[model samples]
Target: MTSNAENELLERYGWPIEEMDFGREDDPDVIGCAVLEEVEGGTSGIFVVRPGLDEENRTGFAEWAVQRVGRYFEHGPEPDGWQKRSDGGWQLWVRRVEMPPI
Candidate 1:
């Protein structure tokens, strides 16, 4: 996708697009981060999108990510974590950070 298209999607979703070293030597596309504010007094989480995936997989990944993140905030517990699956999808994981006193 063109940079303009990427920018438009980011604008629509209110997600911040950032470039980071994704630890891949040949990957050219920059990774994006969609940060959601903390809810119910919980820590915020980052939703990562791998733009380097194939076009078909990118669309599927985007859809899967949206649903997964929505479920986390709406029904799941607070401070949930996630990672991209090796098979080209997302997987929600339990966060393991030290929390401040409540």
Candidate 2:
């Protein structure tokens, strides 16, 4: 079962519940939440949540995200940091990682 916090996160991030695939490594999906800073060169970080893996192995996904997203920022949270996967859900990190280099 997904907690209220998870549901709220989904809503805030615009991630559709139907699109989430939990415990299915063959098909993985990424859900991201970002906050743009008004200041120039200011830091902006996004919390990414993924689904489609077993609870025990979900942390791996988080670690992968941290490494992939951390490249954009000068520093970021440790790779070990991650909330447990609930109801076929996991989270990743994205900071100042934008596309098209706006």
Candidate 3:
């Protein structure tokens, strides 16, 4: 189940369904993290990162989070693109593994 805020975003952004909690960063400035897995037909996962402070633009928090995930997780997805949310957060798309056809 998604939070009310998330639900609003889902409607507003037309995001893909089926999101998973990928966990948060240890950085004190970052919070409310999750990953929308297998987006775009399993080609990518989207990183949802909420910062503790108010950010006006793409302040590299998404990139920093991506780097952190890469260092902690083995063979993590690579960053494809990102966007600053209206609520002062960020959503980053990362490349995911491709599955074989059935």
Candidate 4:
């Protein structure tokens, strides 16, 4: 609902639940990914938890869908390869890009 609430949820993971379809960037597919369609409210969304890097100040992607779902509360949804599934669900794939060898 509110950003504070969202932040509170993300505080533990460090993955910013970036709004889905908020913006588009030049990137490729990632290695790991996750898609979450709320089992209750029916609010569908997606996010990625990388192993080396996460949302803001962390490293790694969620190892499970159930865990990834808890990474909710984003201002909107995920970014990049996040897509809408046939079941009206959401899907997020890791972006495939080299971070300039950083």
Which one wins by lDDT: 2 or 4?
4
TM-score of 4: 0.37
For every model shown, what is its TM-score relative to the native structure?
0.40, 0.28, 0.26, 0.37
lDDT of 4 by residue, 44-89 (tens): 4445443444343222333333344554444334533346678856
Instruction: Give a tens-digit lDDT track for model 3, residues 1-102.
Output: 344444444454453233234444444334334343433443233445443323421224344443544443444333434345565433554322347999
Task: Show where candidate 2 strays beyond 4 Å.
Answer: 1-41, 51-53, 74-102
Task: Sum up the clashes in candidate 2.
Answer: 6
lDDT of model number 1: 0.47
Native-to-model Cα distance after best TM-score fit, residue 52 in candidate 2, in Å: 7.9
The collision pairs in model 2 are 21-52, 22-52, 23-52, 23-53, 24-52, 48-92
Report the number of clashing residue pairs per model.
Answer: 0, 6, 0, 15
| Backbone clashes in model 3, listed as residue pairs | none
Pick the lDDT winner: 1
TM-score leader: 1
> What is the per-residue lDDT of model 1 for residues 4-71, given as tens digits with 9 covering 90 to 100?
44444455555443334455445443333444455465534444555455555445445544565667
* Candidate 2 residue-wise lDDT at 45: 34
**Steric clash pairs (candidate 1):** none
For each candidate, the alpha-carbon lDDT, in order, equals 0.47, 0.38, 0.40, 0.46
